[model samples]
Target: MSATAQALRLWRRAEEDDAWRLLRADNAPFAVAVLAEHLGGDDRRVDADELAEAIDADLDEMRSYGHDLPLNARGYLTAWRTAGLIARRASEGARGETYELTVDALAALRFLDERESPRHAATASRLASLSMQLTQLAIDTDPQAARRLERLRSERDRINAQIASIERGDADDALTGPRALERLRELLSQASEVPDDFSRVRAVFEELSSTLRAKILESDATQRAVLDDVFRGVDLIGDSDAGRSFSAFSSLVLDPALGSAFEEDIRQVLERDFARELTVTQRRRLRGFLDELKIRTAEVHDVITVFARGLRRYVQSQDYQRDRVLRTKLLSAMATAHAAAQTTKPYTPVGIDLELTSVASSSVGALRLHDPSEYDAAADITTHETAAVDWEMLRAFARETEIDFSELTANVNDVLTASELPSVGDILDAHPATQGVASVVGLLSLASEYGTRGDEVEQLTWITPDGIPSSALVSTHRFTERIP
Candidate 1:
């Protein structure tokens, strides 16, 4: 059969499948809606407990509306998985299986939730998109250089005319009122879909990685050939349509200057009269949509980076050489076995039984225990008499007294009271070191509590009792007098 006929047959079978029927079921809409609301964000996987928590309120509402909803979310998820609408897989290092909406299920959910009448701005934005896509297609497929050059010239002329209009302070070309709202709506829709795009891109990278790993293990190809195939697969993933789109999206979203400009533009747009007409929920959504885009883009970039690192390690370690060696050994062993089987008297395999004893068990009877009676309980006790403490030595050991921080604080207050605004040096000069370096530390601590005025520096010098000079460099301290 032709590939087209096979595809058509498969499509027809899918249309009549139990999964498709489940999607069309009466309760499917509610179930899908709940799933989308919960697992639609950066988190693509939902555990049983999380799924239950997310849909409990929605299920209750449905029950109140006289619709029967699934009480056990885990069972509901299992049933969907059995029907091929959802996928359940063991989560890495996690106890329970994680559930994710299969591609088909997501498509079906999207179809069901699609807007009957899309936002007003969607029509014009779609037309612009279509025009852009057509232009790209022409540039890609058309062989006429003159026609492409003409198109470019026309575009440049249009841009020049717009610039001239702006130079003349013309207000006619500016977006406003309903038109501005439509554009804003279009932007919001695009931004909201970015997370979904990221999820799809990440899924593709994971699938590619799995395929490369399986090929490396099972293929009987040469080491160099295997390595080449792996590298080619990596390149294809990085250069594929989805990969290219994600690269462009991430570049734009991750640009520091562009991100800043986007935020500033959003702020200015939100202040306009047309923006004021939007509902609070719509306004909030627009405000946070760019932030969500940056976050999702970062996550996708991180996942791609990790996958690339693992791929590089696999290639650098020459793992394919080991796989090729293992394959050769297996082939050689199989050939030897086949040759032996064709002999007049084939080597008969026989099992041999040998008794073995562990060293611990063998030495068990040889171990001798010390007689308990030989070890007297009183003989085991050894005690030393406590020595009497000398009061003079104890007093000498406790010679160092604790420095009082309160005293340091009071002294700083006194100096600042007299000088109005004293630097750290001034405070230290007013209070001589009674506790050596510790006293200076206390003064600096008190100065820090009062706060510094600026980046001005002050040097404090003090002499220890041993006549060693010590100095401290401190920022200019602003001392405020205590009110009480």
Candidate 2:
């Protein structure tokens, strides 16, 4: 057990000890009457004699029992003729001065005296109090540290409240029943009979049984609002479409990526009620979404690299200003061609269009180094211009920047060469929804091609609702596209 746990156990053992029971003769020297008399009080010089007479024998006996010199009783008396139990200060004033318990000692004894509950509770209460005091002390010593401690204390209180609620079964508490609950045991036995999906079933059942484990922690509104502002700067996503979007604001958190954090947060909430009322299809769907998420992560990473390169190009060059008109003309023409091409029914290409559309280049124009006149110094401008550099010079610069030529530039040639990337069809084939189909090129492009090639685009490309016939869209009233 932890030190806190051990101390709690000892405190509880002591709380269960009642003063009346301790005073019983059968309790002997360890009895309350003997222990009580050892407490002394500041009763002045006259009452000192009486207090001394009453406690002297008990003190001597306790000292004989190996409690030795300057025990609490001796110290109390030396300090004040009176040192006694704070609770009995009234009618037993004289007796009180004769022998009384210290606050900590009283707390220990009270913990031992409990018959109503575990003594650990009293210990916990006292420990919490002491801990708060120590916390306050540290906060006083460091002003900046004080602010963080306040946040922690608020978090601690929230957690404590949640724990209390669970213990009381007030909110969404699920764990219930006696040790070795018979119902749970029987259910497990039945679940084991079907061996194929044991792990999944057991996990669901555990989530169902133990979902009350969220620690019931909560922060205050003021702190909550402050945190709201801080995290607002973070695009924390929950169950909405943003959560599913790879581009969600939360995905950009530097400290800890919020996409993973969101998945984990929602998983905790759902895990609590996993098997409670969940359908088999729902379970499968959840698992599928998680699997899809993992696969999509790699796709997102690749897309990030492509975009990063685009950004660097934009930042380094005069892109839009130089290429805007040409790009617009090309994009418009391409869109028209694509729109018509998508409808090309009988001519639908079944291959992996492993090509990034000529769209980006259409906007930028061709890349080439040329001089119409052979005598022109186009190649030697580097020697005359202020801001001048070329590709070969760049390669040399890279070699110079690298600390170790042998290690850093060892495979630079291979890295510089571009490799063919995996195709779109390959990616879609890996997904569960479309995995059964070995060929996806036709499935995805069929509608678009039909639209372009067929005489009636609307009739060819529009989707009728599930279970409804295409005949439903025959009416002129409900179509997005009306062109024949």
Candidate 3:
């Protein structure tokens, strides 16, 4: 394309792009700040309610500072969603929804991060890394055997010379402090892009999945072929270009030797005196980089697997055909309506009154059982004079019916004060259940509020009211610190 044409194309694309739109939005600073604060770092996704609560606090703070943010957090979030900056998804195996930054929003955030912490374009470390990568690429891709061999021999000679110099006690060959910091910063900057890259990869798989489903829906021939492949146990999504690329990335991230080396390097770097100059966040990211990468890689793999299986199941079932039929009926109705609109006035009422579909009517047997006490009232309800309160009797009644959570709380706090994380069983062991199973239930409730749950179940033993030993297997829970 010519320069003007190419420039015009790029300008149109920029106008349409969500990242570009986010950067140039009216409340760009406010939006970006809120999004980065909530969705950045390890908390890449925040629960919908939690995100709203956090942003609501931020809005209040900004409003106190004389900003004109009239809408609440949910309202702003909805607007941002419409603008394609944020996305909401159902949380895995959890109630309610979660909000995450869209791929474009992640890109914009990354851009802002890089802009804030500017890296020199031509730093020595960057240049050296690029040069080394290019040299390796050249050596690996060279077609001529002689040229490749020559490059290999030259590399071997350089390594041998380095070994000889190191053997001569050339400790001065180590990188200077400044140079090492520069390299470390460069590595971190590069590492920062990885999260965005993973987001993009996931987006690509999602798009590819949609495209495949669209193809199936649009073409009967393609549907048959896809079904045949699926029945043969072929993974169409995994065999795609995006899938292959992610597969390679997953393999690299999961590699044991590479992981070990990366971890060791991080440990060595952290131990260096120069590392003290690095921020806590930088140090933490470096330490957890490999493990996080593996986790993200596995998550992406699961996404691919889920999409593939869902697509196959969609095709194998009659859902698509039913949907196709529904689509046809809706379109036909639209056409009929259009035709009628040409002849009849829009305000004119039709003869028919449409009723919406609803649940089937059932007898009162499905309703709650009626209680005479709930509705009954005495014909003459005489009021009596007030009397002195019976505190001891009230206490006896409460002790008989209530769970005695105050006692349970004391038990839990006593156990937690001694142990960093104590389970329900631990609390019971430390303080036997005074209220029998009621105390156990109360302890579990307290644990649910303040403790972390484990996968394994543990048997909680307690003495019954009659002094018989009672036990029940319950999911393990651990508490940290005293529950004040």
Top lDDT hit: 3
Against the hidden reference, what TM-scores do the models get? Answer: 0.54, 0.20, 0.70
* Displacement of the residue 104 alpha carbon in candidate 1, Å: 2.6
**Which stretches in model 1 have alpha-carbon errors above 4 Å?**
1-22, 41-48, 69-71, 81-100, 115-122, 132-150, 169-171, 221-224, 227-245, 305-484
**Higher-TM-score candidate among 2 and 3?**
3
Point out where model 3 deviates above 4 Å: 2-4, 7-11, 331-484
lDDT of each: 0.69, 0.39, 0.85
Residue 445 of model 3 has an lDDT of 62
Which is superior by TM-score, 1 or 3?
A: 3
- RMSD of each predicted structure: 23.5, 36.0, 20.9
lDDT of 1 at 336: 88
lDDT of 1 by residue, 106-185 (tens): 66655655664355543776687788999879876778988888888898998899998888988476778887877777
Ranking by TM-score: 3, 1, 2
lDDT of 3 by residue, 1-484 (tens): 9999999998998889999999998889999999998997787878999999999999999999898987999999999999899888889869999988899999899899879977786889999999999999999999999999999999999999899888898846688598999999999888988887888888999898888777666666324565445533568999998888888878988989998988998899899989999999999998998888988898898899899888877865547778778777998999999999999998898789878797555987667767889888868799999999899999977665556767877878777667778899988898998877767866776676688888999999999879999999989988865677
TM-score of 2: 0.20
